[model samples]
Target: GGTIHIGYFDQHSENLLDAMNESQRVIDYIKDVAEYVETADGTQISASQMLEKFLFPGNQQYAPVYKLSGGEKRRLFLLKVLMSAPNVLILDEPTNDLDVQTLAVLEEYLEEFNGCVIVVSHDRYFLDRTVDRIFAFEGVGNLRQYPGNYSLYIDYKEVEAATKKAVAVAEKSKETSVKPKKSERVSWDKNKQRKLSSKEKREYENLEKKITQLEAEKAKTENELYNAPPGEVSEVQKLHEKVESLEKEIDTATERWLELAEINS
Candidate 1:
């Protein structure tokens, strides 16, 4: 059976080593904290190598986990989780205290991970980046499954609410049999969005493809950065810059596409 790993760090952990600086080095923490056998890939890896590759270079290699900043400790915990090589990862509020850079890197790692990931986070951006499915808790101990990322799910919900309002208005008009004036039909008026022009339609379609390409490129560049060797610092830096530029472009394109979609509605 596959293992389920919960990547939760107890802030108030009472273990003796957790209190002391026994795991004096981040490398030592990684080696001792998680249980694992050597990977079949036969790739020789050292703690120093992982530190450099994950952008935690120089002094960070030997820094004690207890002495590290909150962000650093979070990153270290994440590294330990990865080293454990579990088939399923369940992260509870994984974004707390993590810097933007670390978050981005972790998102990239999740994207390329071979196993399933179940993430619980209040960060909309993080949810949009890491998950395609969500289990939302409704009242009365019920859980609802929503398809797509957080942004897409939100859009779906808004459209659904508008549709329901329109239906309710129609049903009420049927029961009353009083033909309300145009201005009185508030729900209809509210949802009567503008239609798109031919040019706008074409632009929206093109943007969809372009945005997909950009996203794929961004993910690829992120993986490149994650897998970059210690000596390929320049290559990694260039890839990072490309990812940032691509993200901005994608965001602009996505926003324009959304605007066009609203008009098309």
Candidate 2:
């Protein structure tokens, strides 16, 4: 029932091209929306000034829309939508076809925007930088709300998975109720006293090297995740998974190394 203005940006910019004349100059296209618009800081700027903020220079502003590059056209369309001054912005896959420079500027603009931004994107880095809350869609028409960003949501899921695994192991142990006999326990202790086998010695040396390599790889992957730029959704996700895999490998190798060390001692 409340009055709210909505601005929608479609990933497929071709559909919106009908509203924009290819023969029209970029500055005229924006001026058609508004000659002057107020920024979030309560400062009024003209159409050309606003264009410059969006990375359009004086010469480029006078060029026809048809002469602009594909990325530039996409940026112009986005600026047009924002210049209309809507209270709510709905961007669908906005990162598609946008260059890194434009994406960085857009992130900054969203940070200062007073309106509500509803972004539907697969870009993990974008979501982590922009939104504080997440609405995850599970299968079978179930939608869940998380109170944090994309990274936080991933942490929650990992914790949930570990908890479930632990509970299942506990339940299985209770059901089995198995214990070794006294002779079996003595045999195990004797086995621990024996020196490492030839094959195990080789494996033990390899495990130490493997663990060290895995640790280095994990550190590099973590640094990549920390410094990754925007619009790298698939790369970021892959780096996260690689880090997890390396951690598991390090743990397993360390356990084997300790086993061999105790036997050699």
Off by over 4 Å in 2: 179-265
**lDDT, residue 97, model 1:** 54
**Model 1 worst lDDT window (10 residues):** 8-17
* RMSD of candidate 1 to true structure, Å: 13.6
Task: Quote model 2's TM-score.
Answer: 0.67
lDDT of 2 at 34: 94
lDDT of 2 by residue, 70-159 (tens): 788889999998999888999899888578999899999898887788989999999989986677898989987654568866875784
- What RMSD value applies to candidate 2? 11.0
Candidate 1, residue 241: CA error in Å?
Answer: 33
**lDDT for position 152 in model 1:** 52
The residue pairs that clash in candidate 1, if any, are: none
lDDT of each: 0.65, 0.79
